[model samples]
Target: LLYALLHLSGFEDVSMEEVKNFRQWGSKTPGHPEFGHTAGVDATTGPLGQGISTATGFAQAERFLAAKYNREGFNIFDHYTYVICGDGDLMEGVSSEAASYAGLQKLDK
Candidate 1:
């Protein structure tokens, strides 16, 4: 469903055909997202909370880079990290810890 939505929303990296072949060998779609394996996949999320944790890490890195390089009127590293998580992800200790750190670091944006 997520892939379908992304494709419908004009995310060229995702395709309905790939969604159909999901979990098949040599297919762009996999059981879990693999960053380098697929063009639009930013992180590998085989584990329940891995996506949330990885998103937090990406947000933190963006924040750090922005702080170091952003100018008063030029926000070079300005971007948003969007994460889709479920109750299972919230149940994980790693997700809790990563969420806490993201909150503390003001990475909500």
Candidate 2:
């Protein structure tokens, strides 16, 4: 699946390296969430709420990047985040914590 995505996204133009040979850390493609892990995946999310937390961080980062990069003419950072919380996610304490914070921050859309 990863190989297919890389190829579809024009990564073939850059390099055709295998993932296992990729370094453990500090490599562009780390074993996990190295930001440099892949061209697309913004953050490595394996844990229950890690993805949600990273998503919240990305939302915050987008706000900062928009201010830094997008001018009045370009509102590129305008977006929304949709999280589908299942029974499992609701049962997780981390998800509960994140949801509480989001509610306190009035982040509902």
Candidate 3:
């Protein structure tokens, strides 16, 4: 599911081996969706709510980079952040906490 999303996001050059090897062998996707370890992943997340929480960071970073580097015509660093949080996200307190934090930070986009 995630691989398809990455492909749709224009990560055409991404590969399965790269995704599987993002983290050390022992890790389950290295505890989450690791952006740093994978070629096209946007963040490393786990513990249910972590994925959405990290999305906020990635979105903020995207905005920061766009504002810092994009010129009047050049719109580099502009992209949307997406997350498919599971049922567990709402059941867990940490998930609510992350959601609250995102809301408090005004990360609407």
**Per-residue lDDT of candidate 2, residues 1-109 (tens digit):** 4434555677742244544445545444543443545675555556566666555656666667776888887887777764433575567778777777766766543
Model 1 Cα shift for residue 52 (angstroms): 1.1
For each candidate in turn, the TM-score is 0.86, 0.50, 0.62
lDDT of each: 0.83, 0.58, 0.68
lDDT of 1 by residue, 5-103 (tens): 667877776788888888899877777777787776777787788888899889989989998999999999999999888899889999999998888
Estimate, for each residue in 1-109, the C-alpha lDDT of model 3 and write its tens digit: 6754564566644455544654557433443666675456656666777777677777788878888999988888767877788898778877787778778877766
Give the winner by TM-score: 1
Total backbone collisions, model 2: 0
Q: Candidates 1 and 2: which is better by TM-score?
A: 1
Model 2 whole-model lDDT (C-alpha atoms): 0.58
Q: What is the lDDT of candidate 1?
A: 0.83
Ranking by lDDT: 1, 3, 2
